[model samples]
Target: MIEVKNTGKPDERRDFPRGHLDVLDLTGLNFGVATFDPGWRWSESLRELAGTDSCQTHHNGYVLQGHLRIRMDDGEEADVGPGDVFVVPPGHDAWVVGDEQVMVFDFAGGMAEYAKAKG
Candidate 1:
């Protein structure tokens, strides 16, 4: 098991809409850290990352700050705020809830098995 302390490693930047993202921890678990800048929006192309309706994985995370809106493939949505812990299943999509920057710790690397279903 590897422990990741946010303070130790420098965040790697990735381009997003209206803002940017710092991605880390993509070694084995496929899991990574994401820091969303204010008013940030994920690329629509990433919608494909949602896998498929049947593909499912359990995701647990804590919101460091700000809020986020999670939209499931079935059109279900949830608004998450600071200090909130969330679990996301398969067939879902998410985005920043407001203008506040969102810091998220996520675990979903195991879901790669669903890749075949993506096509």
Candidate 2:
């Protein structure tokens, strides 16, 4: 079987402060394009909505534009720039590194429920 799709039209779009996510769900994969604007921080933008002290969603993605920094709950941290592929486990905080918007393609379904209101 073959599945063809484009980011131009996602299955769902989720908006959060300073950024948004475009999600595409397939038969065996959930993909997402996450756009984080300058000054966007995961804790400040989605913590309340997620009801977690730190990000609980695992992330497997590649940076397409700009830079991003991730700090794990244990204090381990790293910065990712264009052309970088990263896998971040749950329990971390992330933010845009500069005044540029950060664009990433997530293949691990991290954004599946990220930045969504918890009820």
Please, what are the lDDT tens digits per residue for candidate 2 over residues 5-103?
999999899999999999999887889999999999999999998999999999899999999999999999999999999999999999999899999
Model 1, backbone clash pairs (residues 3+ apart or across chains), number: 0
Error of 1 at 97 (Å): 1.9
Per-residue C-alpha lDDT of model 1 across residues 47-69, encoded as one tens digit per residue: 34543433254667777788878
Which predicted model would earn the best lDDT?
Answer: 2
In model 2, pairs of residues that clash are: none
Model 1: colliding residue pairs: none
Clash count (model 2, backbone only): 0
In order, candidate lDDTs are 0.58, 0.92
RMSD of 2: 0.8
lDDT of 1 at 110: 47
